[model samples]
Target: MAFKLIFAALAAVSLAASSGAYQLPRSDQLQPLNPPIDNLIPLSAYIDGLLTNAERMKRGMGPARPSKFSDGSVTRREPSSTPTSPSNPEPTDVPTTTPGSGVIRIHDPSSSSTTLYWVSKDLNNFGEYGRTDDISKALTVTLGSDSGRFSIRTPSPACGCVSDLPFLGGIMGYATSGGDLKSSSADYAYLGATVETANGSPAVSGDNSFTRATGISKSIESSIWSISSDNSLTATWINADGAMVDAHILYYAADNVLSLTADPVSFVNNFGASPAVVSSWLSDSTLAVKATAAI
Candidate 1:
């Protein structure tokens, strides 16, 4: 039956060529040839052999034998390198930062010092300073999407009775006077937008200025804030003039302040003619420690 099927396929090909639908070589095309009767095998048997060879290749083994019926052109299907299922997935590198609640610490990148951390100074302002003996002063940070919020683990009367104040008012810039980081109620804030006070007053203006008792609004933070795989923090925003502004955190030693600015050179150059110095632009190694579970 297999031999008859092969002959029928060949006949169809000959018919098509003769109709000028296809061209064939001017040779012994469609000419009947004598089969090697002594060595001839059924087409079904030959197909079974090929299937068997395929199974062997899947098992990462070579073909058992060369074909004797036709040209020795048996190609092997190489095993796929990709994982077939979740049960046997390839290993992947773990990410440094995962979305969720966490606490953040800062250190000196040059020295890898762990003593310094992100702390709330003067009740409302933020700065990177030593918090080695006072863990309560450390800021509990939560980040998701483009938004981030900072709060204290313990509220102190000295620092004001507020516990949940939006860090930097959810915008990247200098701290403003008469503004506290605490709110009388539980509220969230978005980045790159104006903040509001608990009394429905504008907390921080859209221009990054702060008024009394103001906090940012509850919205997704601006895309300006990004955390790299190494936990480096960077801020990129568009100014009113439609120009891109890129900035990194810098520590002003004299004022003990951490401010984000695109130009560190000018800030250092115009250091108020004082003996105070400003640290170099902070990088992930210097600015951020690995995120820890929220306290």
Candidate 2:
């Protein structure tokens, strides 16, 4: 019995020595021991071995077990807080058509309103017609009639223009260009009208001739003239007499009556002298008109 006890004690000692050099302390407060070697295993390895041994002891090795693995793709992950550089930055929304390039009219018969499009082109030009009292957005064509008229009245850019007519208002007629005037074109201003016949028609100097014959220095500075569908010539002018004139010269094709208004009322330099009171004078106002008639 004494020999048996000695043999059992030796076996226990051998098993303990083979298992590990020292027992790992249960308390987490203890600082784990590390081996002083070039290639040293971390404290976590010892803990992992301990856990494996404990698990093996609980469930004895029976058969080969399949290893478990987590899929990186299937794992639910959070978006990175750090911004990543994009290969191609997202493109911004761009408009298909440019503003002021051309007119885009929308007529709503249900609402009985026609929406006109007139974007700002030149520096002095505005986006909408008739924004100024002298100008009109009357460019709508009559249905079944190949005739339309639009007038643009604007100040000469930078107080300087080809006419050298001070910073006065000048006009552009869409009808003069046969409704083909492009706002995008650089030659859409008075400066573009270099000669009398540069646009489509020459300004009628018949009135100027009449005034000159009467010993008057009355002449049209920048004028846009168009013939109406009924063969009537409509002329809008910036006259040298410092007045804006809209003349309707009618000559009936049937009767051959060359009619002109006698004693045509003239507006003062700024239309604020006889008819308009000087109290409500528009100091820096001038009138310029250009009409493009269907005829």
Local distance difference test, per candidate?
A: 0.35, 0.25
Q: lDDT tens digits, residues 1-295, model 1?
A: 9999999999998998889888644342322111123432222221223336664443233454544536756654433467355575323321122234343444555554445554332332321222222434433344434333221122221232222223333343232222222212111121211222222222323322121122221222133445666665554434434454454444544444444445544444433211212221222333235323322
Best by lDDT: 1
- Stretch of 10 with least lDDT, candidate 2: 276-285
Q: All candidates' TM-scores?
A: 0.37, 0.15
User: In model 1, which range of ten residues has the least summed lDDT?
Assistant: 185-194
Q: Residue 45, candidate 2: how far off, in angstroms?
A: 99
CA deviation > 4 Å runs, candidate 2: 1-208, 221-223, 239-245, 249-295
lDDT of 2 at 229: 41
Residue 74 in candidate 2, Cα distance off native in Å: 99
Q: Pick the candidate with the highest TM-score.
A: 1
